[model samples]
Target: MPRVEFGMKTESGEEFTINGELTDDELLTITNFVQSAEKLLECRLVQCGNFLPKKITWNQVSGFDICEVNEIDFEALFACLHLSRPFILQKEPWSYNSVSGILGRVFSHHSEVKRELKGLRKIYSDGALSYYFDISIQEKSIFDESRFLSWLNSYQYHRDQDKSVLYDELKSSFSENGAHHIMLIRLHGKLQAIEQLTHLCKVIIKSSAKQS
Candidate 1:
């Protein structure tokens, strides 16, 4: 798929650029940006240690992960996404707390990643992150099992008792504050498709206005 480059300028003379492959849902979101009376885009960066998947399909990611070793730069990612939209960057620990959160959501079969988003709303004073992305997707996530299995494999918790007890701990840790590697990206912006794709979606947003 062809990559699209996006550029924008703020009323205050700031300039920003981003290039990536968009998913179908993302394209739809961007299209909505163009039609809606709202011109602002709410964007946020989901950074991780590893390179993000080259091609992300719509609704493909079940949830995001961030272990202790893979801390993302919240400041940088937030700035990039904030430029294009009314953005929010949820801050939490990227440690055992994150692991436990994922596990808690799994054991309860709840997929919203509440554990991952500890202190999210209080920080923003904006009700919740759902104002950006559909929190409902979590209830029906496709990668829940995968995330759970990945956690199990990470610690090599093979013994039955160890696994059982760990599950309980995860549920308990759901309410604690800790670091999380994953972040959410919810954008409301215009979509000018530079190119379409059979495998992946690619588009661009450019500004003819000069920087101040």
Candidate 2:
């Protein structure tokens, strides 16, 4: 039988290499396992890499390998797998707000975001990180900077006022780190929310200039 090799990190923060033949049974097992884990963790299965027979045929698979089958919940795992398969197969544009919604749900469910926020809070209690905005631009323009700064300032002001609506406005008007963050989590994929954000910024700048 031809063999394939891949690597994965377990929940315990341990790294292990997986080597085996690619068979329908193995595929189904992996799919089932990933599905269960996703339900327990409320996330999605993202393919990290593929193994072909050519790469592993000659070399002995050797490393600090540890193997164990930790207990798993089968039902929840399959549910998450089912929810995620369609999204994985389709190529669709993800909006900033929609991405944010997905992430909010994940963070609330997983507590990983909460843990990170706690670490950040220990360093900066006043939420100074809120002031930092990442703006991606293809071409530098004074008008673009002005509009972006204005939008950012407006967002900050509303945030300070405890306005719930500002979250949507800011996410829609400016790119969201959370959206990009979640895409990385859910699909193990990179999202061009920054590109979409820059495009929106340019449109806003052009429209503002036309009005003047």
Candidate 2 regions with alpha-carbon error over 4 angstroms? 1-64, 92-212
The per-candidate count of clashes, in order, stands at: 9, 2
- The TM-scores, one per candidate, come to 0.21, 0.18
Tens-digit lDDT track for model 2 on 96-153? 2332333333335335433533443322212122233223323322122223223223
Candidate that would win on TM-score: 1
Determine which window of 10 residues in candidate 2 has minimal summed lDDT: 48-57
Best by lDDT, which number? Answer: 2
Model 1: lowest-lDDT 10 consecutive positions:
190-199
Instruction: State the TM-score for model 2.
Output: 0.18
What TM-score does model 1 achieve against the real structure?
0.21
Off by over 4 Å in 1: 1-69, 86-138, 142-179, 184-212
Error of 2 at 190 (Å): 9.9
Question: What global local distance difference test value does model 2 have?
Answer: 0.31
The C-alpha lDDT values of all candidates are 0.29, 0.31
